[model samples]
Target: MEIVKGSGFIPGDLLSKINSPSDLKKLNEDQLEQISSELRQYIIDLVSVKGGHFGASLGVVELTVALHYIFNTPYDQLVWDVGHQAYGHKILTGRRDNFHTNRVYKGLSGFPKRSESEYDTFGVGHSSTSISAALGMAVASKYKNLKDKQHIAVIGDGAMTAGLAFEGLNHAGVENANLLVVLNDNCMSIDPNVGALKEYLTDITTSHTYNKAKDKVWELLGKISKFGPNAQEIASKIENAVKTSLLKQSNLFESLKFRYFGPVDGHDVVRLTKVLADLKDIPGPKILHILTKKGKGYKFSEEGNETVWHSPGLFNKDTGEIIKVIPKTPQPPKYQDVFGHTIVELAEKNLNIVGITPAMPSGCSLNIMMKAMPDRAFDVGIAEQHAVTFSGGLASQGLVPFCNIYSSFMQRAYDQVIHDVALQNLKVIFCLDRGGLAGADGPTHHGAYDIAYFRCIPKMIVSAPMNEEELRNLMYTAQLDEVKTAFSIRYPRGQGVMVDWKTPFKKIEIGKGRKIKDGKELAILSLGHPGNLVTEAIERLKEQGINAAHYDMRFAKPIDEALLHEVFTSYTKIITVEDGCIIGGMGSAVLEFMADKNYSARVVRLGIPDNFIEHGEQVELYEECGFSPKKIAETAIEILKENKQTILKQGGTSLHDKQA
Candidate 1:
């Protein structure tokens, strides 16, 4: 690693000469094109070792270089939608030195962060937010009379298909905002994009008649401009009339009132730079449709599975083989894979069961199920709001719909959850993957609020599985006819503890919890995968002569009240732990339950705090947040010492008993 970094990692590279957009401006079109190649190589080399987002960044290398070269960024507002593609943007914008440290603990963030750099005008992780954000910046600039400050939203074709993107387009078109929506059409967003917009864009790109007619109309309009002021007015009328007729069959952006520009070669940095420079003079909301290959430079990434290459961990750059960090012992499958396998297993038995993922079939491992039951499984592209309501529609019939979405992405459709599913009392099962510290992807991707968000909604049953076996049972139980309310099963990213996780399925009682250990003095109640951490803490505490009782309270919403009553009665010192934010999470629910029951037990809540947690390894983040095994053990010991001190201070009359 040191050899790779020290041996002219940047000094020999073209990127070393370019620090900021200013450096990019110094280079000619040819030099800039050369720099784009260098930039792509740099990303591949670094990401192959560091392992951040792959294909998206690779796809946008030329576009990133062109945008930076053409626009005076930092001074001008440049918003990147789904900032995963902004790796080249990060490198060009004074982060080349720290780029290798990407997505590491306390290192550079994988996505764009406003606090990280001024050039990153809007921080992003989730998709389809760029247009609205860019428009907001553009509108603000307009209000301030900063006409020269260009606000460009570099969004992918997949993000462009999102409903929010259209909402931004609608407003920008009406307001005539100076916003440039650069549509980076690679026809992919994690998985290949689906739905009407992709098809429409494809049709426009392929149609020779549409392009020929549009080009002819523009030529006539340019010729009319040569006449005079009266001739120019006539040209404008003729151009709009011709464009209206020609574009009606082709352009959707024009229909929304945006002056649509391209289908230009995105990889050609010189061409892209020229187009962008020309677009600067043009007024109102505009879209530049640029076509680029997803994994342009790398043969491996281009030829290999694009979905797998999107964010594959460390890999061999030359051979294109993924480098697996193997443990001494066999490791368990990822929680996503577990969910994928479980859903397929359950779906096989139940004919009414259908699987749905919002443009995340590959991400959530729902492709495994999709492959098995193509008709039954659906990939609704980048539309969380629609996905929720669609699931409600599916459940309106007797069919059981398992709507799988990442916990962070699921936040986009909170209103839909309330209005469409919960209000309707639809028995739609929301399988929220990445339901904890979504490491490396950072705070934007963390599933920190789902417990808080879903538990509060009336008729919503929120459940988190401790292991793969439990996850299977919860899915099985959720589909039961007796369960008529909206159900949510949230699980963390990465692997579970169970190696032989394919245990025989059993019917788990809803709202019930199981006691893991019986001990005196203190009782530990844990929710979800964090229970594995708590159990480890308990084992380590036993060595210190501290016997702490433990309970795996699976259900966060209809929490084990029966178990809590027993816990409050038996144990004076209670510790409630979860993987979610403490404010309105599982721990808070327990506190509320204790208060309602009038139990005066001293409760210590251990979980993520009110603040947003940044990216890192999950265990490292857990430790920092005071929820790791070592931290939990230390906390338990401290609690025991405090209790012992209070008893000693009270002259042997236990304060816990007195309080109780």
Candidate 2:
């Protein structure tokens, strides 16, 4: 690393001079190996302190360096599938200095943002998008008569399992476009890749039969010079004969008309650069399969659990020890963990219950049940739509399918939810994790829309838990025979409220809300974990001599109309808070209820605003969205201070957009 008259350390020698791909172009191909090392080290340096994605970028150091070195980025179009491994790409493309701010509030985003850099062709957080996106750019390039332009989609093998990726590949093969799909086969996503595709890829990547055939063909090509002009044709024929026999069914990419290239070493920067340069000259759609380890360089990440190292918050780079802050007291368990344990408990009692997740067993803690009862759990790889539909299939039988999906990812499977599950009126327990603002991942990952989206769906019971106990109760209730049809239980990413959350299983009556406080002033209705915020806000309001009523409105769909009626009759002033969008959310349901009953109340809805919320801490994002305890209290105080008649005239007549 080099100081280079800067405040902090920057990239070393070859890397520091190279501001962009143009600068990288100035260096000889031989120097790229050194640049790759420096880039890898820099990523390690920054991510260890700044706390962002770790192993993925380390794994793709060579690929990122080689791609930038070979292609005309910001022009040729290089799109990373998920941007988990694009840290090196960002650093090389004019973000080296500012890389420290990665995933920080108002700093560079954790994932690729088109607005952040011209080089980042697509704004990506989700996987399996690069192939389709790059194919679009390639088709456009062909239309524009830009012959020299190249469009490359660097996708993980884990992402390859998605129907979208296959759809893109199927389309790309038919299109006459200068496109290259670099399959970075690490045999892992966040967790190890699953399904038949992983097995097929494994066979291709590590089969003795394929390896022997490959060596024999290479040897035959080397000795082909002994023959004459027909040697090239003869060699090609021999290679084709061997490939046809061995990869009869396994040659999936080739069957789609893509000129499939080797399962090459992705870490070999020199070979990679050479192959990429050569492919750019050869037109049409093709795929280059390169095998890479998830955590390629760093010792700890390379040896440790790839999933844990995928986004290991912080670490000691020298010692290889992951940083940890040991709290004095036992903290509350993560909501996912609670769900993991609770599901196992339920599945043990009910033989018909099964768990399902799309490429996120560990992330959502489904891995716990997967380990406990292997037959009753599945990890569908990076295919949210498939997971939902597959769960629906399970529901078609007598089995109760607990389909766990992240709230943000569930958006991808909206069609499946509506058509496959909801429309069929199947008993699919949709356990939507990361239910609210997923902090630090920004708009792409925030679980702000599930409440609105799920609530709108017919026969879908949209619900969120205030704490772990509620999560357990809700999970227990959904599995029961009483809760028919598609039921969704949304919960946030972090820890729940209660430390002793492993309470006895209890059943919660659907649509019935619980009152936390009784007050004279406005009533505060909250949905999900954000109800805790209302509790704090109500306490704050009392300090200011204003008493506020609070209700934990658990279910958004069959919303507690009776409970809402009780509150409406008692208090003319109301504040509805939720960790979801103000539009079409629980608050909206309250407004709808108010209008339906022909009641007048000053309804101030506090939640995520109309705009996209950026990356930050959970607290910071809560404050930004104006639903933090402080903001909630302030909004209530303002509402309480105003004259009853004037406030009623302004807001009581209809909904108040306090968020707007």
Candidate 3:
């Protein structure tokens, strides 16, 4: 409860005494406990000062310390599911110096990156991947005859609900792989976990009466088996019979062929180390379930009002009050907020409207709609595939279902979107939030590939809103029965440039693009939040004595040929920019158009690079990727200059010469 400063902890001199897991070997058990306290306090201070995933890191502080102290990391291969809980892992693994720059540009990444450090065994961002990945490593080690090396996967109880986790469990159990799966049961995900599995775990962890009865049964069986060696055989049959019945009612993990261990006290470092030491020697798909509270050590964070504290902004460490930024005169709502509020308004008018999200009610702002219409909005709990298919079922029943999922998370449900929604041509509105470069959360959170992936699917309508007003209108348009096709509207993460919400809802003529500006020398086509950058680029071009036309081609699919034809006829050069991969994105559509029609206008495409983008501030990343207004304008000018040279060389009248 008390505010623990970094100064009170053991100084750097003591920390410097330990370098690796081998270095931790010298520390006594009591010293290891001090190390855990120091590590927890360090995490509290680090996250409190420079905001990242706080609660996840706080909950795993002791576990992380115990694992490092007990196991030979980097060599032993410790894989963490979800990676949000890797802050303490980072601290102990020689990244303590760079922890201050966590999640910032060119600094420590928010998630595990294999290239970042040798200790980070596998790069992880999405959840429920550790078990399968760790098993693969274990199998590889066996194939190479390196059976002495250990493989451990620390997954949360919430992560265990994911079907992939169980699939991995089944395979590992069947193979009898030497793998340790430590289930960190904190009784929460980003939000509290849902579905039948969560409730089952809750029963196992909380049911004292059931546990007592089971203990009594075991004791009675022991007494009966003591009569003779033959009685032991009878007792085994009885135990198996009772287990079979109990498995039908509870304990899903044991049924999946795992030796389920305790729901132990996760915060107790000494106990965890002892258990882990014991488990290390005997392991074949064994699970040690540990119970820990999120935001365990820090009182204020534990009782914080908002999940904003889960990954909070800059704040006062003492009081835990988020530092309030000076309010501007008026601010536009976040794109997610607009989408959330719009869906609720639409749902109010249409009783058939239903909202769904995959463990992201708060992140996607679907919580707003959920609050307004609790019966209609459902949180499917990190199961994107289920959310999509569930929405498909709802749509089949003649209901308008809106499945709100983050653009990054939607990757998990790609097959479902194709087979269940698009192939079936279900009237489901896929509201994709965080469609572009999501800043602090890093590469895994960037919604860069949604456009390319969704565009190829048959019967799929892909659209991006240039502003908050267009976003609202697009959501309204997608709701219409006439737009019965499966539709997706992707918008970025932050506020919508303070745009007023006075724009009335109307169906945008499908695939139609609106020209925001008129010019002669060059044309600029833009989509999503990057349309603002287009406007800025156009202004900069005008200042440089270049006439540039700008168009907000809202829908990526149905390629606005009419608008393209207009630009093809009017302009000598065309340039396209979007916050997505250029390979098969809006720019590719334009290039395909030019190629199909045999139009010869010089075209330039600017977008995210072909490689994976790392963690950084959004502005810094955009500027680095050449998506900024200044960079786009400069690139446009260079392209236009080359266009004039080509015309001159071809003996055609150049725009510059004609103007002169």
Candidate 4:
């Protein structure tokens, strides 16, 4: 392993000694403190160049060091919620050498994967699973009669706001499992957390009356415990009674039957280690509330918007200045920006239009709408299930709620989408941003199944835009007063093809497709952003004397039967391509349509396969799945040649002549 040594790189001589959690156990409290500083600096220097999740990892450096130091990891389970804060945990657990390759293709995963390491007991990418996983581990240990083993779950306050966290808490409280849930309260999760829970936690952490009362009660109980079991029982009853009556307003965790501990300083390695060591001796489900600032120890990150600095692209470590590589040519706006800007414009004209995102205003570009119309826009915290149902409620009252959620996150609220919106036939327009491979975020973040999931449901209109203009038009059409069905518009992560995409809002016909090029013998049909690849492939095929017709079939659910009949009647061969999984995707839809209509044109399907794709650049992933322009062109060429051979073998006229 190479030790990065330079002006910016902090002296990590102490850090270099740490190969595993057992290695950390060898170090004293003072040395552990040094390791914490080194770990934070190492992450700062590493992420400065490589660019991964910044704020969460930086905030949890001390906690990571302390947990491993106190607990026997690989035996004692430590499940990290969301896995953004697990970088330090990964580094300390024998991944330090390969840490630089984080989030890269075929490199170490950015999040925890059980297959990656034995230390990673549970794979995690989404938030609020840690408590449940930890409780399960604790229960499993008990089943095996292994009382010596411990289970700890470190979760952020932002993730704790989710309903899943509460469900886990409710179950764990009832189970009375030997589990410790460390709440890393940084008052943020991408953006500052909102709602009643945030307010409640803020009050508990800040209230002098609550703190003083808790201290006095504990002090009285400790003194009374010295009088033996009889007096101790009386003391305990009195304490519980007092707490249940007076502390009910603040201590919600205790109400759930878990022993709640302090708002301790999360950055103090020595104090955190001591607290963790003490907590190990105690029994049952517990929650240690530690207060830490997001983007701690870095001056610029501390001063700037921590939200932007959370995953700000590569930057200079010493100066904290973001390294912006200027593009050689003018580039098109991102699909997210198109949605962000267009919603504000549409909302201005239509007062009924409102935007809601599940704790992703900045991510989905709904921050633009939030800034323009504060009353109309809502950041509903990390609650996908609630966000969907809340939108349903708004839609019920005759409001046009544009529920903007990431494609992957939408899976959490599928029940609500079916029950609240689809069943009621409410006009809730779902703008699924990141509707394809989510690039570096990998399989957990990819929006590969929305088309299949939504298309299977009744009264749900599923569509994907080929470009920025189409997305804008789709938004316009969905928001129209006449449209009553539940509509979903999925668009990809990065920039769109059109530079001048701020075209006037024109309504797109539902279940309609337009041909991009004229050709013979083969017709290449595509859905969503993959149509851009089809367009490029068709143009390239033209140079090879292989003219193939291209169509952007916008709607996946409502198949354009009229266009399909025309293509099947005209062409001898047909190809379907999409950016989602092949099994139940656009290609599958086409195959199902063909079988029902009995139009057999020798169909070929191309898309992501049945298996999960790992982290990589979007282009590389698309190419791997055979959805890239070059790959699509190659497939088209192969199909065209085979069709020609079939025609020749049949003693028919030339392929072009037959088609003509």
Ranking, TM-score, top scorer first: 1, 4, 2, 3
Worst 10 residues of 2 by lDDT: 651-660
Score each candidate by Cα lDDT: 0.87, 0.87, 0.83, 0.88
Residue 315 in model 2: shift from native, Å?
Answer: 1.1
Backbone clash tally (model 4): 0
Better of 3 and 4 by lDDT: 4
Please report, as a residue range, the 10-residue window in candidate 3 with the lowest summed lDDT: 2-11
The sequence of per-residue lDDT tens digits that candidate 2 reaches over residues 163-218 is 99999999999996999999999989999999899888887877777776765554
- After superposition of all CA atoms, the RMSD between model 3 and the true structure is 4.4
TM-score of each: 0.95, 0.94, 0.92, 0.95
Model 3 agreement with the true structure over 1-660: per-residue lDDT tens digits: 322233233324345555566767788888877877777777777676677888888888889989998888888999999899998898788877667788989888998899999999998899899999999999888788876788999998778777688889989988777899999988777887878778887887777654646545544543552455566466456546556653334456667777665667799898788768766655467787788888888888788743665677777888888776777777778888898888888888888999999888888999998898899999887678889999999999999999999889899989999899888988999999989899988899999999999999987889999988898888888888788899999999998975578577887988998999988778899988899998988899999998888999998998789999988877767889999988899999998998899888788888888988888988888898888999999988898778767777998986545766
Runs of candidate 1 exceeding 4 Å displacement: 1-8, 11-13, 211-246, 326-328, 655-660
Q: Give candidate 3's error at residue 109 in angstroms.
A: 1.0
Task: lDDT for model 4, please.
Answer: 0.88
Residue 258 local lDDT, model 4: 83
Give the Cα-based TM-score of candidate 4 against the true structure: 0.95
How well does candidate 1 score on lDDT at residue 146?
Answer: 90
Query: Model 4, 154-248: lDDT tens per residue?
Result: 99988987899999999999886789999999999999998888888888778776666765554554455345546636645654765665456
